[model samples]
Target chain A: MKVALVQDTPRLGDVATNLEKTVELLEEAAHRGADLALLPELFLTGYRLGDLVPEVALRLDRPGPEIERLAAVSRRIPFAVGLVEESSHHLYYNVAAWFEGGELRHVHRKCYLPTYGMFREGMDFARGDRIRTFPTPFGRAGLLICEDAWHPSAATLLALEGATLVFVLSASPLRGLGVGRHNLSIDTWVQLLTTLARFHGFPVCYVNRTGFEDGLGFGGGSFATDAAGNLLASARDIDPELLLVDVPVDRTRDMRFAYPLLRDERPELVHRELGRILGRTEETP
Target chain B: MSAPVPLPMDAPELTRQLEAFLHEEITKAGFSRAVVGVSGGLDSAVVLLLAARALGPENVLALRMPHRDSSPESLAHADLVIEKAGCPAETLEVTAPVEAAREVLGIEDPLRRGNLAARVRMIFLYDRAMARRALVVGTSNKTELLLGYSTRWGDGAYDLDPVGDLYKCQVRQLGEHLGVPREVLGKPPSADLWPGQTDEAELGFTYDDADRLLWLVVDRRVPPAEAIEQLGLERDLGRTILERMRRTQFKRALPLVCKVQARTIGIDFRYPRDWGL
Candidate 1:
């Protein structure tokens, strides 16, 4: 499957301008023969739209004209994009929507909302409790927003649910110098993505945005890895980029067969251990 | 065992990066100009130079705010910067405002007086910023910020900071590279809050020593025991630095907002300061 990852800056609270830019980038990705395109988390309204988020939040189930225009574009080349979703019940969620054939295919609301340091998503949006994989034209895939990917269980559940690929949408900032004098956050993310790809024997596409919002600077460096954990392509930090890579679908099945780690399953043991940690008695089978 | 290598800083690269960062931040914050407090100290001098370079000297306003006890050399060095940088500047004696506050509070202690002076200077800077429609660019270096040596809400309040990430030693290096006068660079670092006051004497350690130890402990995340053993930092010094960092962590963040509601400002209703403004 050919995928395009957009690493671009979004103007805060300007949904119209951001959507126009996204459409333009999606067109560019299509021109490059991409089967699917991925945009960074909150690409429509920007990640740093603090108090203005609720005002600009989109209702995906009853999307406006701007979102409808994006859905139309997705008919040409299926894409996944992130935005602030306002439900009919008036609750807000940090959501990633997969669109194909001018329709919303699957919507993955972010489960983990970061509230530490510079992030306050927990206060801004309701937490998503469910994790499920959905079928794509290329294969079954799972979607995880920025902070959700930080948890191993999030990815484990997706892989267990028969997802051959996972897409992580993020707006992570550039911080502390790493142990090897590298970009610390980017290095840590690379480690996490590669570990997930290797352990689950499935490919992972990570997308991040670039540019500064107030004092915080988002480090782009979006990337993709094969099922074997080899990096295929990456975008540059601090610049707008549309990274396109060809992911081999066959690699997932081949690697899983070769490793057989998934075949040697232990869910009952995991459940028992979790029950012990949670101080609850399990119903023994 | 090999000696621990000092962290390398590239002065030119850092200056270029900071200049661009300040320019973007200032312009993005809806201001085309910058207002900077110019002290004789290297930190202020470096910030003034960077702000001038970022927004051009014509767009930068350098303010020389001095209390009655402020060193005469401070004014002279500040004048040198104004003259060399060719930026517009003004000398405002902070004696009246500081004295007024001091008299009302009946405060004679040096620390309280110093804090008043710092805040008084900030008031002047902010007034100038508002009058000229410019953002107040900060000059606090990383060492001072990490050590929490700054007077909170006084020298710490800023719309943007160009040199906050650079350590004091790195600031000196950048200052020298930016052609700040040799006299200003040569002088012992002091806040000039009182007569015969030097930063090193007050803090009980030189910036070079503090920078090295802090680089190891904070940036390198070295264990305290290992930092002392490997970097040859005194245990007490390391402990003091760590303790100051711990105590002043609150100073670096927004005031604690008790989460009683669904969305509390600084708790859940947080957004970037530049959002929609």
Candidate 2:
């Protein structure tokens, strides 16, 4: 399956504008012949929602016009867009939703809401507690928001549950320069995505947003890696661009068979050791 | 005593990021143009070039506000930057307003007099920015800002600062990469508040020495007791650097509001600076 990494710039707290731009970029992705397209985290409503959360968030249970437009776009090319999801109650979540053939297939709410340093996610978003893989038109897939993929266990759980492809959506901010060739934030992400892909034997498609939000610039180095952690396609710089990555979805079987690392697994030892360390052996079955 | 090495940087990468920063910030603020004070110093020259590139040269208004005692080369270097950037340029004589303020306050000390001059320049820039529908771009580098070496509301007041994160040495590195005139790059760093005032002489430390210290103390978060020995710094310079950073912490932030409401503005009722933008 050919996945297009949509490195888009969403205006802060402007849903109408973001929805329009997202549709236009999705068209671009389809024109480039991508079967699946991945947008950055919070692509519909922007990343720093703060007090504007209620104003910009959408209820996905009864998807709004903003989501309906994307679902319409998905009739031809299945795509995933980052969003701020308003729950049935007043609570909100950082979410990524998959739309295929005018149906919402799966949704992944971000679990790790970073609250330190330049981030204030914990103050605004209710943390997600679920990690699972779902059936997609392309294949069984897993979706992860920016910080959720930072934890290895998030992706590993999905792999164990039978996901052949993983899409990591991000809105990572740009920071730390004057030391390396790349911005420190972008550099770290490249390494992290590669490790996740190579270890899980899945082609990882990463799409991060670009542009400045309140004087904070985001790293826009959206890219993909093979199952062996080799770079397939990359962005030009920290500006808005579209990157299309060809994923050999069916070949993941060959990859896993060649390595056979996941086959010789010992999760009981881990669950029991983790249980013993935390003094909670009750869940160690 | 340790002689601090000049900081190194990826100049091309910083320029790309900084330009994007200016473009998005200025656009978000609802302005397409910028107003900046161009003293013939390295920091302002670099800022001028960056602003010019971010918003095309025609969009940037480079103003030269010089006092009577300001060095002739200051205006000459300012001219060099304006010419090189090919941006819109203006010159202002700030001597009258500054002298008037100094006289009314009965100020005799050079430092106080210098501060008056700095504030006077700020007034002209802000007023011009208002008339031109532009935002004032700051030229204060990280080294000067960390040391609190600028007038609180004078050179420090700006709508946005593209080069604020850059230390003096890093600014120089970027300036060189952007092709700032050699004469401007080679000149001694000065505020030009008076005839012979220089930044290093007034601060009692070189930027090379202070920049590495700032990085260690602030960026790396090294303890003073440990850093002094690690860098082999002469004891007093290290002490004064930390003191300046601590004392001037108030200048870097908004004025503190008393906690009367359950959720005060700065303390708790926090929203991003780019709210609804």
Superposed by TM-score, candidate 1 places the C-alpha of residue A275 at a distance from the truth, in angstroms, of: 6.0
**What would the per-residue lDDT of candidate 2 be over residues B221-270, giving only the tens digit for each residue?**
88887776678888898888778889988888888999987889889776
Give fnat for candidate 2. Answer: 0.77
**Residue A160 in candidate 1 has what lDDT?**
86
What lDDT score goes with residue A161 in model 2?
80
TM-score against truth, every candidate: 0.79, 0.96
**Global lDDT of each candidate:** 0.86, 0.86
**Candidate 1 residue-wise lDDT, B1-277, digit = tens:** 2265566655664565577678777886788999999988888889999988989999999999988788898989999988878899988999999999999999999999999999998999999999999999999989999889989899999888877877887788888889999999899999898999999999887777678777787778888678767767677986887787789888799788788989988866766776753
Q: How close to the true structure is residue B171 of candidate 2, measured as C-alpha lDDT?
A: 90
Fraction of reference contacts reproduced per prediction? 0.34, 0.77
User: Can you give the DockQ of every candidate in the order shown?
Assistant: 0.33, 0.68
Count of clashing residue pairs in every prediction? 1, 0
**i-RMS, every candidate?**
4.0, 1.8
lDDT of 1: 0.86
